[model samples]
Target: MHMIQVVFMTVMVFFVIVTIHEWGHFYFAKRAGILVREFAIGFGPKLFSIKRGETRYTLRLVPAGGFVRMAGEDPELVEVQTGQTVAVRVKDGVVTRIYLDRLDERSNVVRGEVETIDIERKLKLALNADGVIESFDIHPQALMISKGKETQIAPLDRQFGSKTVGQRALAIVAGPVMNFILAFALFAAYFQMAGVPMENPDKLLIGDIVAGMPASKADIKVGDVIDSINGIKIGADSEKMIGIISKSVNVPLTFTVIRDGKPLTSKITPKKDPDTGVGKLGISAAIPSRPVSFGETFTYAGKAMKNMTILIFGGFKKILIGDFKMDDLGGPLRTAQVTSQIAEQGFTQLTSWVAVLSLYLGIFNLLPVPALDGSRLLFLGLEAVRGRPVDPNRESMVHFIGFAMLMLLMLAVTYNDILRLVRGEH
Candidate 1:
């Protein structure tokens, strides 16, 4: 049951985050008059679908990733060639529907062989009907029918590439921007609920004690102000006390604390952390906090967002400089595992975790790597600088190669995650 809950929550979280990211692109594309063909969640075989306006919304089998498909973005053209037979539904000399499949005979449906066609630019078609060549203008809202399914045709004006570079850049970058917005909102919500931490660097007061740790075993409690350790007058310096404790791992140290106007002494030994090799007393510094005002809540949330961004970038810098191991990286599997653990901690912790994940997603997408939003913006920047776009075929090939490499990297990290799980390592 616990595993099931974790799986469900993980799916829900992915759904919400991906939906928001794709919706950002979809919304801006529509506003820029680009025809958004589909707004799909997940990839692979479609499980559910519905058409609204010009866009088809779909849920696919895979939950790992999703995309907002814009017309003209795909390299392959869905076009009718010369000498192909097709059925058309015309209204007042305008072709409103073009069917690529055989349809039941009807007075409104005309059968013809295509002689010349331009559905994208000119929106016109010339066909030979019983040796008589006829030309007809296509309606702006013309539909293409294939396998009995209708999809509106996109003219040149409605294609993504037809838009200005500024519009295209905005549509591309909107996905990552929406992610940052979501992170900010989540952080604000969490701050409103839990209040921001107010820490004092001068005092060596014990605010919280971990269960079964050295301090707890030594009978030290929260609200106890530590006076000194090992005959050293700490003198309100928490860092000095921490230094003393960390250097004395597994070594007994005398701790004197003032509790309720009485000084008491206890001998505690710091335990070594397996991961960081740091000594731990399993106690946190005492900090006082209160609920923030409505305006202050946003201020605190903004600060939190800034701090998280810096931390994420710093971690990336360490990885780039070879200061961090590749095994430290986590993929989707590790994310699910961590999500399960945090969910068990309670709703507040889960909320904070989600906020952090959202922020990471936003920042990662903004990196200047191929097949990502940042790379698309880079191409647009070059286009603006050169006064012309790069060759579409070349650009498409670059993205395809980049995408393949990313998939391989994902598999590698996922394998590492599985190995860690098998070895009983978190």
Candidate 2:
């Protein structure tokens, strides 16, 4: 049952995040007149799918991630291009063999592998019965053979590589842009429902308590309104009360609380924190909630989003600088565990977690790593500077290598997560 809950939470979070991310790419690709072949949520075998217009939307079994399949995105021949000679061998008005030929600089014939096919087409060849020297017209819908297989050569404009750098960049960047927008919207709704923090802490009620800290050790609950501290009266001026508590760092302070209107007292000592060299109780007073104006709600949401973005960026920098511990990194299992905990905390906490995760995912994909949006943007940048796209085969190989490395990294992280779980460490 516990495992089911964790799995459910993980699926819910991933479905929203991955679907939105893929939708971002799909929307922009459509907007740019690019062909999107598939927009799928999840991975592995398909559970169900539906086609709308040019795109097929699918729901797959694996809930870990999703993807958008764009036509000509991979290095493959999708259609036949114009001005290319195609040879067709016909029998009973049906093509039995097709061959594609290109001319070298010296006008020598460079024939590709032959392919047998069945089609009906008439070619006006400049050849005798010996069937030696001949030329043919390059026609659309004409039978074409490539590497002993019948395939359509993609039209130039239909290919992603044929798009202008700006268009390509727009499509690549859209996924992350939509993710940020999702974070903003989630934060906005959360702020509106829960109310943003006040400029001043308005009450002496405890809003947050750090576990294994002084307050938690004293059995202080979040909603317990503080009546007094160390025989000093607690007032609405939270700063003054905090100052008094801070001053009594090493000394035991008597906290008078009103739980359900019944007064109780508890003595606890605030220790000096090693990191900050400051007296701390590891508790934050609640800020009184009030209805916020529309403008204020958006303002608060935007600020929250910006702060989370900065936090993620700072954490990433710390990782790069070796400031973060190896144990700090987590994989899917850990995420699911955290998700379950946050869900139990209530909707506000869960939504906040979602927003943060979405923001992180967005930023992560924007990194200039191969097989990510940032790498594609880098390629587009190169194309913009070079006045031509990178060779499709080479680009594909680079992404393939990067993708394999990512898989290995995922496996390593997952193994670490399992070890931590076995040791009962979250």
Candidate 3:
């Protein structure tokens, strides 16, 4: 089912992406002799964990977030965990698990349920305070576990200080690079296995024609169904549709199409988007062919990867410079949709997305955003430039501000995504 594909793609994207990003930090941190504590996937209460090396690599209950925790250091990435009830106690930097039924609390019965009456709330309720404040919908079941961390979250070590600026920057930049590497490999492997997508003819179908664009201007309407171009019939023997268009660039070409019970002629000139150097008439193209070429496959794959990277880069730039709106931002839902589409289109398409996505992952991480590997590296660069460590306090402050801003931006994009979903805008 298309829906199933979407769900699968979404999971694949997250796992692949998250692993690469975190691995960047993990690898470099280990190399830099930092005391890494936790390498976790997903955020929230840990559903499970494995203690390995000097770290607890965790798989948390919340699939939405994950992070690597370093001893004496706060991560730019935060792990948010969810749990029904986890009874754990910390003492002398040791964490020991305990059962929750053994704990006691003063209870007041209300509506056939036991609850602890909030003394402050009772006062406020007695005053007939009305507002969201007056509505005390406390979940006593979700009690805050008071046990302190048994392990001391140490400040990032002076050993981190001992590393050359380049090393520190590498440690910071590696996470994003890992994401990109993962993406490219994933993409290339798929391409190698499934074969490069050749521009096929018999399977070609147009889904959309841009309004007022060359295609529409030539009366090439949707459902017109193209059969040939420039008297070269399109069918089983048709090869190089792109080549044909490239040859016809800036020159009018006739399109033979079937409309209703009659054949029609529509003439359009292929024009270049200039920026991409691709032939276009604003027509959407798709095919049903599965072609495999053992020879030159890598060459074709490499070319596709390059194109994907270019497109992704341009898209990211648009977003950065405000040419793209926040509503265009994708969160989990959109990712799921894309994953499904990619999977349905076949592994080759999916792989292509992976490569493109990987490049995106790599480049985006390079951004100088706090809590991001790139931002950390940027600060390290500033330190190196000054020939001294920037004041740690100021560094911390800037990162903190960056982190807050990043969170806010994420919230905004997520909100936009939800709004679009509500409007059934996909």
Candidate 4:
């Protein structure tokens, strides 16, 4: 049952995280008039899809990943300039409009019209007479969304990038916030299941044996339940058991075992394993688990969240400094294995890990590198400083580069994860 719970939790968590991530993009893009071509809830082949307006909302077979496809400055579009916009020159009363150069979707040429019978004269009058050039050289689309055919806008500003900077940034950040929310809710349910475990501390006890010397020759299991050792009753308390085992370490100790309730006597010398230099038997014993208080559980949950974030950042720093190999990272298989182990330990442990994962999701997404909330935040700060927005083309280019970097990073991490799983990292 615990194993089943582990599998279920792992699958559910992946699905929830992916769904929430994509939803962030979908929500903000919709409100910002950004046309979404496809809003997917997972990766791989589509399991099911429904077309709504211009968007095809899809649920894929693999629930570990998802994406929101939006438009603007996509590399997939190609076009030719028609030479519609040109530069206007005015000296005295005569005005002259001349074609400077033809530019396309990505072209930096500014286009607009000025109504003046004597355009040249008007420029001198406006420039020399007024001596004030307010809003000159300003590009309307500089701060606006780069909307075009390649942008995948089914209608107009329906692509993800078409939204305002604030909208886009918020959309990107929503995914991680949802993950934290899910984590909090999962743990809130876990705090309810606390009690004494079924097995008592005394009945489940540990016994030791020597290596291949004498006890090993008798084929003694490390965790064999000894009815009595050194003619002293054990299992009544840990102190008595420890005393008996300590005194008979190197000597031939009589161990009475009640195997299947049958009285049996065995004599064996206990020795440490030469390889590990630690007293041990061929096997290990399952010790009783200690129950914790509600306060302890809450504290553990918060600490677990902090620890996970620290571990993630520390690992990232190590990798950045070339001190840690990418193999330290894990993908779905490792996550599933970990999830299962946590579930086996108890609900609190599992939920605590979930909270940790949530923290990871939030922190990683906020990094101010291209295709992340942080990068958008950087632009926002710049706009605030400059009192205006940046060129749309340049902003889009930076984001494109960032997206490429992120994809490469994800691919590398996934490869590392596969390797860790195949090699049994734990």
Candidate 4 RMSD to the correct structure: 12.4
Tens digit of per-residue lDDT, candidate 2, span 274-338: 88666688888876677788998789888898888888999989978999776888877788778
TM-score for each of the candidates: 0.81, 0.71, 0.60, 0.56
* Global lDDT scores for all candidate models: 0.85, 0.73, 0.61, 0.57
Model 1: residues >4 Å from true position, as ranges? 1-6, 103-108, 147-149, 198-288
Q: Lowest summed lDDT over 10 consecutive residues: which window, candidate 3?
A: 123-132
Model 4, runs deviating above 4 Å:
2-8, 31-34, 43-47, 60-64, 71-164, 194-275, 280-303, 343-348, 388-397, 409-413, 416-425
The per-residue C-alpha lDDT of model 1 at residue 16 equals 82
Q: Which residue pairs show backbone clashes in model 1?
A: none
lDDT by residue for model 1 over 1-426, one digit each (tens)?
276776777777788888999999999999999999899998789999999888899999866668999988984345788999988989999999998876565357888899999988898899899999999999978998887678788889999999999999999989989989999998888888777655544446776677668988986776687788998977667788889988888999999888888989999999997888878888877544458899997898899899999999999899889997768898888988888877654566677888888888878888888888888889999999999999998989988898889888888999999999999888
Q: Which candidate has the highest lDDT of all? A: 1
Q: What TM-score number comes out for model 3?
A: 0.60
Most TM-score-accurate candidate: 1
Sort all candidates by TM-score, best to worst. Answer: 1, 2, 3, 4
lDDT of 3 by residue, 1-426 (tens): 367665777677777777778888888878877766688988768878887645778887645545766543443212212322223333332222222332344132111111222311221111111211112332211122233332322223423655678877777777777876676576657766765444644545554566546886776555455578888776543345566876666888887776675878877888876887766777765443355565555566567667777887788789778997667788655665566666665665677676666677677767777766677788888888889988787787888898788767766767777888799776
Per-residue lDDT of 1-426 in model 4, one digit per residue for the tens?
366776887777666666766687678777777766688876679889888766788988754567787765354333212322333333233222222333233343333332221111122211221333212322111121223221221323444444566786677667777776666655544544432233556654333432345555663454456567667766546555555554554667776655565756777666655664433323233353456586765664465566666788997788678896556666666676777766655555666677666666767777877766677778877876886778877988898899778667667777777777687665
Candidate with better TM-score, 2 vs 4:
2
Worst 10 residues of 1 by lDDT: 196-205
User: In candidate 1, residue 234 scores what lDDT?
Assistant: 75
lDDT, residue 281, candidate 1: 88
Worst 10 residues of 2 by lDDT: 111-120
Question: Candidate 3 regions off by >4 Å?
Answer: 2-6, 44-47, 60-65, 75-148, 152-159, 197-233, 236-298
Candidate with the larger lDDT of 1 and 3: 1
lDDT of 3 at 259: 68
